[model samples]
Target chain A: MKSLLKKKCHRAGLIVVFAIAVFLGPAHGYAKAETAEAKSECITCHTDVKKLIRLGWKIEKTRPKPGKSAETAGKG
Target chain B: MEPYEKIYVKPSFLKTNHGKIGCEVCHNGDTKDPDWQTAHKGIIKDPTFPDADKTCGECHEDITSTAKNSLHYTLAPFGGVIKARANKKDKRVFEKVCQAKEKHCSACHSSCGQCHVSRPDYVAGGFLAGHLFQEKPCMDTTCASCHGGRVYAEFTGANDEYPADVHHDKEEMTCMDCHTGKEMHADATGVASRFDLPERPRCEKCHPDVVSKKPKTSSHAIHRNKVACQVCHAVANKNCFNCHAGTDKKGLPYFKSNETRMLFKIGLNPNKTKDRPYNYVVLRHPPADPRLFDFYIKDGLSDFNKLPTWKLDTPHNIQRITPQNKTCNNCHGNVSLFLQKNDVTDWEQKANAGVVVPQAKIPKPLKEISPKWKP
Candidate 1:
């Protein structure tokens, strides 16, 4: 009788665990799937929106002033 | 930014979950080919438009299905008003009228991107913050872009001499505060008109005790049962009298109209029901003619009396204390502000039926005031 009761309790525990897994498992998986699918190569180069502006400004910084020519830039 | 520069300056769709997919998934341009012409061939400008299933529906299936049936997309309310006025039982003729209007009037639809990412197409949408996906829609920028050209102007005091709505001016309440996403994505139940929707927002829903809280005078207690909140609160608003639509020489559709009158008037309710069973409600002349699309349809909207031309309008410009609230004479004695036989023309008398107050129904003045009215 004791052994039979222990077996029944074990079965009930398993059923409860399985039910929780069945209910909560997909929701967790779905959230992960959402994030995983969101990663892309577009972020690699275009992560920063100010890339174009920064590039233009950087080039201007490197370029010689209006009065100074490319040859005379470093000397000046 | 300059109009031409908007394309390049717009940022890539990188931050959003949508960035996970390759550009080719939504845009049909050839990114592999080196040649500009060949690569750019058949590029789809708006992919999530008309049918959001290809893009937004992949994730937001629950919302997209119902959103498709939403009045904002289906424009069934606009169609309902038009159909009611049409009085045409012939399914064939009604279908033709709907098709013709779809070409012209149906251009103002809110697509997925129009709300979630950029401005509406009507306002010449460019990317909001360089193609960044917006989690929260900006009321001033996004919602007002399309609606602002009229309602927002009145609500926010953008129009000259018009005071802002108390809800906006005092509470600083935005549209999103009252209009929720659940209401916006009203499950695809295929409601014919917005007025028919059970979940349509009402003032009493929020302020349940407004009527219980008695005012200083008996006017509120007396008229509270018969008058709508807008009739007492809303100030004079712009009403476009007549709108004549036609295609230009270049085939682009254009709408020209008669003068817009700024006036306040009380009229009979067009759509009277248990919910709005009031005898007197605020009136507005919507710029819809039975012959609006006659240019396209041979005899479009020939029967106009099917729906009242003077519609029961809920103007956005509401105030706690209006000119009408100051004295009983302001409203009770005023005939010019009442929708009567004299207000409508002979031709429009039929279309304005159920909207004009009969002489017998007009409220009699309690006292006579001196003629010192301001223009």
Candidate 2:
């Protein structure tokens, strides 16, 4: 029974390690430098996300402002 | 040679009379100078060199006003840079997605020289001429460069398919046809403009016939007591199922199954219901038989054998007639009125059975042809 418990514990530990390696390891090195450089360049040129949306463009993780927001700003 | 002859004698007189200026003062003259041609060429080339907003400004200052207000200029530098970066990122993603078979960045992104210079020859004159004149950048070689053969073909088809009244069909219009300058919210460098504004020539340009058919005959007319045209026609076609039909490759007839049509009728309703006070369906059919289909109420279902099937007489006009109210319960609050009206028993049995049903035929799809009725 003790041997079986040790075996199960070893399998659980292996599963945990495998999960971390599969998920975290690849994400860490996934074009980090290139992505950062490209994003920075985009921000440099476009200045803000709102402009991109107005041009019918979209980037991941950017929330579009309400349609009225732009009109209101124009009035100002 | 006399001193007067040296100063005033013409070239013809040089051989006959005393030589002029000793041939060296003005000409720096070796009578047959070897390097003189090279010196003169350099001066001509220097003046002709192209410089945006400056070289072209010499001839066309007014041209700059249109461009400054144009989306291309408004979103320059910053918008362009962001687009370039995004293009690079997209290229990487495309390379991965297409397994490197397809290239993406160059397809959509115009190169630095492509927009700034002209083709067939990349001389200073070419660059200057392009900037001075209001010509579309080279779409054939530059735009088609990385866009692949399929996209090039589609663009050609789209150009051919565009209606004559469409702004793009007008002389010298371009990809910026619908995407007007005022619509451009982003600065050239990719920053949002200080003001975000709705573009003009909105919806009404293409659908002028529908919007302005009659003074009181519009979808807005039905709910004018409640809503406005901007409330519904604000977005492209306002989610009308028919207008957006065959838009998606998957939903298109090429991939659609018979079962799929039975399960969920695609393109039947171009105008989908939205967050308005009352839900309405906009039915559109060719105006050839204008009197046949009624504009108001749900009288069209009587013409069709099934809910959406109509027989077509001519292949050219495959008219799609959608009724105003689709969901019977939406407005009526019950199905009893719908069943009573649409019932075959309500009419004389033989007349009901022999009702001439309209059919759909497509001689050609939404392709531009010689106008049936001259404008």
Predictions in order: lDDT: 0.70, 0.29
Tell me each candidate's TM-score. Answer: 0.76, 0.25
List model 2 lDDT by residue over B173-266, tens digit each: 4444544433432223333322222343344475555444353343334344233232222111101111100112232111111110101011
What is candidate 2's CA lDDT for residue B182? Answer: 35
Q: lDDT at B239 for candidate 1?
A: 75
TM-score of chain A of each: 0.45, 0.42
Which TM-score does chain B of candidate 1 obtain? Answer: 0.87
Query: What digit string (tens of lDDT, one per residue) describes model 1 on residues B130-151?
Result: 6667767888888888777567
| Per-prediction DockQ | 0.01, 0.00
Residue range with the least summed lDDT across 10 consecutive positions in model 2 chain B: B236-245
Best by lDDT: 1
Give every collision pair in model 1. B11-B130, B85-B307
